[model samples]
Target: MPQERPVEDLTEADAKAELDRLAKAIAAADQAYHQNDAPDITDAEYDALKRRNRAIESRFPELKRDDSPSDSVGAAPADGFGKIRHEIRMLSLGNAFDDSDVTDFDARIRRYLGLPGDAPLTYTAEPKIDGLSLSLRYEAGVLVYAATRGDGETGEDVTANARTIAQIPQKLTGAPAVLEVRGEVYMTHAAFADLNANGPRTFANPRNAAAGSLRQLDAEITRARPLSFFAYAWGVVSEPLAATQFEALERLASFGFSVNPLTRLCLSPADLLTHYRRIEGDRPDLGYDIDGVVYKVNDLALQARLGFRATTPRWAIAHKFPAETAWTRLEAIDIQVGRTGALSPVARLAPVNVGGVLVSNATLHNEDYIAGRDSQGEPIRGGRDIRVGDWVQVYRAGDVIPKIADVDLTRRPADSTPYVFETTCPQCGSAAVREPGDSTHRCTGGLICPAQAVEKLKHFVSRNAFDIDGLGAKQIEMFFADDVLSIREPADIFTLARRDSSNLGKLKNRDGFGERSATKLFAAIEERRTIPLARLLFGLGIRHLGEVAAADLARHFGSWDALISTVDRASPAAERAVAADSAELVERARAADEGRRAELKKTRDAIWDDPPLPDGARTAWDDLIGIEGVGSVLAVSLVTTLSQPGERRSINRLIAELTEIQPPEARATQSPVAGKTVVFTGTLTRMTRAEAKARAEALGAKVAGSVSAKTDILVAGEAAGSKATKAEALGITVMDEDAWLALIGG
Candidate 1:
């Protein structure tokens, strides 16, 4: 094959061509690795292809292919194994590279909890076994099922294969009625060597050998392999196992599941580092392959408080070993567009091995990045511009994202030229303009752009959005391309089966679709007709409107019609108010008459001071912006998305096709502070202000920054100020921090 083009030399056309090739290559690799127990490329090479594809997609986010491998997990389950949907998701953990990263992890945990530096904190550290993650479910003390953590939410059933393992117990005496014990299943180094020497097929590593054995079609094959299991976590449980993580492991060990003997409880970061070092030193002698050490918050209560992000738990992180680096040639530069219209640049590098993996691509970030300037215009890489054909150093830490560390100028090709950034959308030919003070350049084509339209459709059916079971990104792309399901907007999805009903040839007869699967897909789409307001809003894919923001808006508006109408009226008025405020400033600067200027300013302020809201309207623009986490910038982005006539029409059409959009359930009224507006004033000695607000909000109270006539209660701490006075004057209930805490049973 011809050598790949240098990243700096790639045009938008070249980038698109390369993306297509990479997508197909990656898919085949995934199928070989997951479905066939045979991989065509090494792990490093596969990672490089994926990394390159992501870099291109990031640069030209709008051009991201529908079958993009970045969105997929492990390949779809092999044909023989039955699929099982997990009751609770098996999330992956973020990685920490070094000692500093571990320390940062601890510090971040403390910061998130609003705990002081001196506060007591503890963590449970254990070896991160390099093996297949397995979940064993026990019901009524009997082992009912065992599965692999395929994609975190769904997995293939390997209960028969699991039963063959000597370490996995068939029954537990003191376990919960419904408990899903999660851990690693691996073959020891000696067992792996023995299997390789005696078995019909050769194995690559202990992890692959264990995975291949457990995923076997024949139970006898798995039974013949000497595999071991280690229980470190639990998924769905009937009741609390223990007060702390360390105690929970001990509890699991008592139930007959093998637990790793190297587990330790550490009270400080220093202790965790010492333990990590000790484990790293003993890794070779442990008989099983271990990648690194995993640390989790000891207190179960704290873990609950930390909650989770999109795909990982906030309470835990895995500290990985240092990354290996390799020198590679700068092949080419590629730009990829995203759903949100961001145009990112990616570096395509000559294939080289880094550590154990192949390194072929790395992120170039944006135009400024390639120019060797940081976001703030500061020089980096010794102020050297990364040119095409220059030998570059690539480093892969625990993260899949590879970074360009340095360049060897001595290896630079003399004829190489500086890269010129694109000024137009490669897909729709629309002007690509970067906003002032922003790093990324966005396409002005909006929904008309094919790339943006497809992405938005993909987002509409994403896990956090409509979450249609059978309608994945690949399916959506296929349907969109074939015109069998042309989803130009979110509303287009619900109308697909209806619009195609009159056609003689149905979706079932189409390629890649069976009659039963097509029927099930339509049913999935129809089931989402009556979606929750928060999910619908999030599905719209508006900028800055994440899950949290959508929830806040839904709670504030209480209904779909209310939110739509409010945004319709408030956005225009808010626009005019901003203009009037600007005019008032100009008048104050130029006018000699102070009285007239003052009057103008007062009139401008009064226009928005008392909102003329319709009766039964629970929220106004001020109320929306006043929400604790919903800042003015986020509010503006929401209003802007709503202000577009086309977007508004599309939303209205979508609503017409769907059933009533249900609002979030109201807060429980059991607590005294539930549904009450609360204000905090002065310095709190017991806890930080943020923690106090969080606690109060958790109890269903709406914590406001300022006291108003609508304030139901005022929590005054030391040196209570004007807010306390204002609350007392307005006849709102006033109480000290201690009294406030007592009232809420804190």
Candidate 2:
């Protein structure tokens, strides 16, 4: 046995350093034990290491790096999964402490764009599983490589091990020639239970069990673990998969990889919140452990445009669920001004440790959260019931800060008042508004609010927006505070290069830059002055106008000048024709006409359908459908959105300030059913089932989910299931995954 050192014997510095080293060592061991299911040390040793690391990090906050081992949340990406460098790194997200954190994140995004009040934005939320991140690569429809996500930039190779999982197809049918899919490798509660049932020792958790399985040195060992995969993302591939995040997951499932069917796409943040609440309610019923919910920009192009930050991407953020609950007395409540000028409430608690961290404050979330009453209807605190000196239960539900979950009336201090949350921006004293049916109170201060200015500036210069050089959150805040940059509005950012030279000179002297860098930054700013219409449109940070929408607008309008003139011309008439805005608006009219054309093309393109639709429809569909991945559904969506006059006018206005050129469209080969939906199912036994599907798809059929009335044909092999049954029921023809291959002349 290794001799254990007494904590009292070590110097403070030495203890901290030792703690850091131990944490790293333990994390590596966890990767080996959980991901690979191979452990180099005993459980006792691993436990000791963790205990020591926690003790040290707790005593020495300054010693912690943002990526410290103490913060490790999941298994390493599985080795044996095919590896590909990401086109854009799939970074992790920062955790939110409370409702304020979620609000702050939203505010930051808005401020970055210089969006006005009432600008609308939406988010898609999904559970953030505590599992290993694995990347799977496929070539010409066959699984090739599997690797673990290491430091985001690099990971250990683990292709053979990933092959052992059943849900992961050795070869995919009806997929592009090349593809690389990324997902989380997790263990269900039942599977983990079964794996440990006959074992001498039981697994502690799914994350641990999954880590152990994926870390196996030999692929055969990994085959025994009851590990499953749920693809939430992609690394990179030669061709596009789907336009939206929801569609992308469906595409991954079509390729025979398991995806979490629970994923949902919502139209607004309010809808997203509803889903989050539902998930919270059902968390205990879920078979896997989830620490947080990740909300991401759904459109792939928008995601790409948003890009990444140092450790996380700007397009996505994680709203952590409370992990645990604690009890403490509320000492006081403090209001803090966020970068977005939203006044957030913080409950100061008598110092109590939760989740091993000493916590003095819990987030009140918003006025609504603080003001809500219990069933008894007793003022829940000072005015609201969560008053000063009241006993409260604090929970660290995956958030950095805990939230007050309950109050103890018996222990409430006599001096406590019903807590009164404010309706004004604490920093700027601007009136705050709480819309009907909404849970949050928002500051209506807009750009004039100081707290929001710096945050907005940081967002405007974010990698996904303007992508300004040598400017970051810290720098933006400094400039705002020092009056070096009076960025009260989005347009103010365009004039930054022309600001006083002294400040610019001072910035150049900072650690990472010099005069040469300063000159280069200015040059970059000048270069961006002539941005493509789509980028400029995105940079404007218009409400609801993301990169893909911007691109669609640009393509629809063609040139910037045309878009602007049309918008300026349409504004006055738009106010009076609100109900028939689409009909009244030029863009809407074009889109509707285009949709009609697309519908006609669909009928004519159907070789398997009786009586073609029309010629005009075919031409309109041709012009509309040429863009990559713009299928029948998305094509319709694009047309429908355009049919709205106000949207068109807004897009046009944005175009006037920018110069944009739509990139060349991808040319699609003349494959059969070039615009049709086809489904293939059952056990295929000729030249490998995967090969047949790929060959058929090469001949041009729209491969799709389940056999339906709309399906052109069903490819079936021996013993097909619901898909085959449904096809026959619907009068759709069926072919074996092999005979279907033969039909395509494979």
Candidate 3:
């Protein structure tokens, strides 16, 4: 139940560990709530957990794990119900915990639309019902089916159970031909109490009772339960409902579906927040349970343009009410070192319930937070540091581990002393150094640290990597601990069976491994001898090198040998470029004159336009940078990994073990421009730069931002610049926009 370390303080190992922990925890929570109608945590607690997970992901984007909770919605439909796939996905709303988040949401929308900050925009604010999400699909104005929002893309068919809800219309008079009305299915407090009093089973809360009742297999049971439906959204409509959100809700109401009376239109963030406050005040008097207020862009066109993330709509956000708080005694403050040596201080508290969930521990965030200071060094909690044996108030802000909000000054333990933050790693005797401008005290042990080495090794062979059948995390741990015939590195796995032949302590006789299983493990390792270039790149465990960046590099470079050559050739140049980039900011710290510093920094940043290099490294660096998705950050990571002797030696060993590195296959092999290199220069009037690049990729052609000797075709637009001249001099095909379009028969 540790809280996330600040993204700025997180290393690659910390990111992976945090992501893994959240994935498992969120999945378990989702199943309990969505599948079993038994929620372990309150809605606010759950939302906060997901929100923090996203914040961390946004910060350490390269280390997002495969099991990330953000990738999915609610758990898969409960057993015994037929599955229903939504034509248009039913997405969850992003959460806004505070007033600042609400303001930021509006700002983000304006930014995306390229509007002035004060530009008038409208949003519809409505009470976010605390109930089970239900999707009612009506074909030709007649209700065809009903489903639960199972996993966003698909759901459970509860058509029979849905028919029992009187508020849900069986047929709509003026609805779209193929309309899917989305709403919340809930029971009022009176109805819930009545059910528990007279029905066969006792219930925990209105939301749980409503979910349990709506999902019942027997229609009679659902009919007997008093349930109400509030239509506030829609999905998979055959025709356009309206131009604006307010109109759409009115349309839904016209079709016999009940829309919430609390829904209102707001002009700005202030209006939205005011409405949110009104709803919060109204919650106590409302018939049904409500957890939060949902604010959405009123213009449907803007919503479409705002689009969505993988699991949530970008235009809308749920502003959650404050979670329940409880006072607890601080038992202990433990510093747990993350994989990347991030020292996270977790507070162990006496057991207490906050927002209906049992909580024993809370994330202290960092040593700074414990010392009563924010990351900016601003005083917090009246500058009073947290201490062991002190009385503290814990609040569940949607995280698995609740956080301590305040200390009870009156109940302060007189014997308490100021807690000293650890200056050395407890796991290893290595000095944990806090670098200047860094919030974390990281162990400088690097690969020598057992904590970092073991986790990296495990990650290298994870399911997203080699995915060896017989080798799991447990087995990897055992092998890592082995002194003889040990599998210490990725390359060591390939030589394991051979090395075991000569070892006195054979792996076959080891605990949890037998002759058959050991042989199977060796076979699994052998099977992975031939891996795709992207997987190999990912398995190398280079910092800032995520799967997407790896795939981009792999497709651009094509082979392992080619990647090594590119990185090697570009290393010295990349080093110089990095130095120049650093100097851009460092110059600000030196020299007295502002004009002089600005002039000096401009030259440093212009290194990207044309870096002055000593060898083929110039072209190498340019090509590496120009390859669409292989940005300077990832390119620099690749170069830095190779620049380090230890990392390069390890990579060389792995490369030696691999039999084959599969080449990238083009998306459209049959396309006329397949496998061709194309560059578009100057102002493109026919399409956007992104559109042109996407089209080229779809045609199996490579799109380079800058022209080079590798450029097979250069599509010259209005006032084609120096790139066109260079392409022509290189004897590369230089075509105008019309010629370029005709070549692909556009």
Error of 3 at 90 (Å): 1.9
| Off by more than 4 A, model 3 | 7-13, 60-67, 398-400, 457-541, 546-565, 582-586, 594-615, 627-633, 642-746
lDDT per prediction?
Answer: 0.76, 0.59, 0.81
Per residue, candidate 3 scores C-alpha lDDT tens digits across 285-397 of 99889888999999998787667666778799999888889998999988777656777888898999887778888888787888899889999899989999999999877
| RMSD each, Å | 7.2, 19.1, 5.4
Top candidate on lDDT is 3
Query: TM-score ranking from best to worst?
Result: 3, 1, 2
* Residue range with the least summed lDDT across 10 consecutive positions in model 2: 1-10
What lDDT score goes with residue 149 in model 1?
79
lDDT of 2 by residue, 1-746 (tens): 11112233233323333433454465667667645665665433443354455445434432332334444533555645444454445455655535765666666565544444467666668887877888787888888777777646566677778888887789888888878787888988888888789654677667778877777777787887778888888776778888888788888888777777567786555676677788878889998877667888777865654554344666777766644467888888777654334456788889887655567877675555566543233454444446788888876453223567788889877666777767788767888775664444557886667766655455455444566666555556665665554544544554667656675777687656688887787677656656655555444444334344455445445565555544444333222223223232444344555556654444333431334423334334433343322333334434444446764664444344334344313223575544455666776555344344334444544455454445778777778788788888888877665465455544
TM-scores of all candidate predictions against the true structure: 0.76, 0.43, 0.81
Error of 3 at 278 (Å): 0.9
TM-score, model 3 to reference: 0.81
Give the poorly placed runs of model 2, Cα more than 4 Å off. Answer: 1-146, 149-322, 336-343, 349-353, 356-361, 373-384, 398-401, 432-447, 484-488, 491-495, 498-504, 510-535, 543-563, 577-746
